[model samples]
Target: MPEHSYLGLASAMHRLTELVIRAAMSELSFPSLSGRASCGLDAACGNGDHSIWLAQALLPEGQVTGLDICREGLLQARKASAKAGLADKLAYIQGDLHSLPFRDRAFDWAWCADCLWPGPKSQGFLGMDPMPVLEELVRVVRPGGLIAILFWSSQRLLPGHPYLEARLNATRAACYPFQEGGSFLDHILSAPVWLHQAGLEKIRGQTFVADLHTAVDGQAGDDLAACFQMLWGRAMPELSEADKAQFERLCHKSSPDFIANRPGYYGFITYTLFFGLVTSRPR
Candidate 1:
């Protein structure tokens, strides 16, 4: 990822997803994280928004260390922390999730987002097994500490307006190969099983739905539409000519025609969180 890349249109969609995750976090009951001067790790921290959130939430004397494989992401994360006046509370480092650079039991908790899916690709994809990475997270988090993973539960749009739903189906089909098991939903739904195999206990999961109605004409709605447009652009090579044209007709925000006729357009995406206690290291 590029420096300051997380501020772009595509990232806005990611931020929306995070918003849903934050709401879920607020509702879920977890052990008191604010009492002691505890430390936590934000694995695959990306631009570090979650790191900042973790630091603020775990504060008083608590700290959050953010680790990512992207150097530019870490740089941007550091800049963001400085901008937020959280440089002292948050630390950014560049490292691989499969082999974290921390000593055993370095953190009281570990949190990851959307980066654990297995796919065909190497650098970006999680490969055929995510156990190595989960084990690494467990290894660094102290026994009895919590591990949380938030990810998109499904790419398919839930039942909605027929036009928008069809477009979403096309979008998923175009992006099929890039996704794990031809669907991100499949991989995300299996998270509990993966966590269990990684030796985590007390596993729990939650799903949050974010609805974007373009007719509302808000910044968030516009941004969500733009994200779909971006996906369409990227998937153009895989899409048939007819599919491409239809996608553009429905999702292209830059089109003046689309701007003028924007009404009754709605989109829905779901995010899921899987959390548990790190009872022991992987056997």
Candidate 2:
């Protein structure tokens, strides 16, 4: 885990690439998404992991431009894309998602992942109205181009501690980016409605699950630990002493009674993608 980082974004994503790739791309048909598109946009690309993969898998010959507002993230993205041999097919840009720095209808396709958790001033979420961002996404895509927005929908960890897990989820910290002051628009399940309201056609959604069982030692274990940390680290203060002890025993890799070390251990995380096609603007 990286110091001063809430989620240990880069390291976690790296260690979880196996599940990440499957969970993110499982429902996607790259051939159908690509077709005759010559250029693609990875909007708000955090580390460019998905960008590089999408470039190689979705557009074998087309260029994929990754856009983000964070300078450091873009720098890391540039490095990662280069390291993945996608330096030729990938480019990184520092830009805001709500105000994409591209001409109208500039991209043939667009992909944005884990970027639309909504709350007032929430760092993890995009922290504002997602409608503006959706509108911007629609504006820049060609009339017939595809636009996909992905959300890290849900996860069921702690196989036997459903009650404790539920308590953890009830905490405001655990639901940070999805706390109070949000409407139906903030909910991930309403994504198709968002796309339709933003003037996109053929809006649809699909969810992919990444399941793992009793993983210990290796990237999977590390990733599982990171997932536990990311989901419940901040919620510790809200938990009771017993709950805290249980969480520590289960989530801490150093604990003698870690959950993953037990037999029949199973956990799964889900990623949901909602996509729509840009439509011609009214004359």
**Alpha-carbon error at 237 in model 1, in Å?**
5.1
The TM-score, computed over Cα atoms with residue i paired to residue i, of candidate 2 is 0.90
My TM-score estimates for the predictions, one after another, are 0.82, 0.90
Write model 1 residue lDDT over 1-283, tens digit each, in one string: 1123334543576655666766765543333743567788889888788787777666467788999888877888999899999999898888888889999999988889867766544345656577888999998988878899987665443233456445555564334434534544335578999899888989999888877665664675567556665444555666667766766665556756453145675556788889998885544
| Tens digit per residue, CA lDDT, model 2, 1-283 | 1213522456565455446564565456555654653688999777777787778766467788999877778888889887888898999999988789999989888898777766554334565578888888888888878888887777788888899989988888776666566676677788888888888888888877767765443456666777788778888999999999999998998888877777677787777889888886661
lDDT of each: 0.70, 0.76
Q: On a 0 to 1 TM-score scale, where does candidate 1 land against the true structure?
A: 0.82
Q: Model 2: runs farther than 4 Å from truth?
A: 1-7, 17-26, 122-124, 214-217, 281-283
Weakest ten-residue segment in model 2 by summed lDDT: 1-10
Clashing pairs in 1: none
How well does model 2 score by local distance difference test? 0.76
Q: Kindly state the number of residue pairs that clash in model 2.
A: 0
